[model samples]
Target: MYAIVRTGGKQYQVATGDTLRVEKLKGEVGETVELSDVLLVADGENIRVGVPAVEGAKVVAKIVEQGKAKKVLVFKKKKRKGYRVMRGHRQMFTALSIQEIM
Candidate 1:
């Protein structure tokens, strides 16, 4: 079965044993996280969709890792004006292993 879960202002379609990186979340490695905002669930030919979210439907995942993504550089320059700006950023993320959907 597969499920669509919402987290950190994003939605992800996941299935059991699948691993994916999502926006930063609390908890350490090996911690269990229950995602209750399940938007859709599908099993073979059967599908269940939520109004906003499916009641009593949830996805269980394990935090496998947490780290920052690669740095992104932002540069801006104004020709002739001798103005320039440079910045770098690394977004934090959490890796999750989907365990089950219920």
Candidate 2:
């Protein structure tokens, strides 16, 4: 079975044992987190979709890692003005291992 769940303002399709990185979530490694915003669930030929979200549907996941993504550099310059700016950023993320869908 697979489920579509929303977390950190984004949606992800997950199945048991699948791992994915999302916006950083609160908790340490090995902590279980329940994603309650399930948009859809599919079991073989059976499908269930939600009106905004499926009531009582949830995805169980374990926090495997909490880390930052690759740095993104931002650079700006003005021609003939000798004005330049540079910045770098790393987005935080949480790695989750899908345990089950219910």
Candidate 3:
């Protein structure tokens, strides 16, 4: 079965054994987290969509990694003014392994 769940202010389509990275979540690796904001679920030919979220539907996942993504550079300059600014940032993320959809 597959499920559409919301967590960390984002939505993800997931199925059992699938892994994905999302906004950083609390807790350590190997910890289990339940995504209760399930927007949809599909099992074979059966599909269900929620009005906001499905009650009693949830996606369980395990935290696999907590890390930062690759750095992104931001540069700004003004023509003929010799004014320039540069900045770099790395967004934190959490890798999750979907265990089950219930």
Which numbered prediction scores highest in lDDT against the true structure? 1
TM-score of 2: 0.96
Compute each candidate's TM-score over C-alphas.
Answer: 0.97, 0.96, 0.96
Query: Model 1, poorest ten-residue lDDT window?
Result: 46-55
After TM-score superposition, the amount by which residue 28's alpha carbon in candidate 3 deviates from its true location, in angstroms, is 0.4
lDDT of 1 at 57: 98
Give the candidate order by descending lDDT.
1, 2, 3
Q: Write the per-residue lDDT of candidate 2 for residues 18-68, one digit (tens) a residue.
A: 999999999999999999999999999999999999998999999999999
Which model is ahead, 1 or 3, in terms of TM-score?
Answer: 1
* Model 2 ranges off by over 4 Å: none
What tens-digit string does per-residue lDDT give for candidate 1 at 10-34? 9999999999999999999999999
lDDT of 3 by residue, 8-72 (tens): 88889999999999999898999999888999999999999999999899888999999999999
Question: Which residue pairs clash within candidate 2?
Answer: none
Clashes of 3: 0
Q: How many residue pairs clash in each candidate?
A: 0, 0, 0
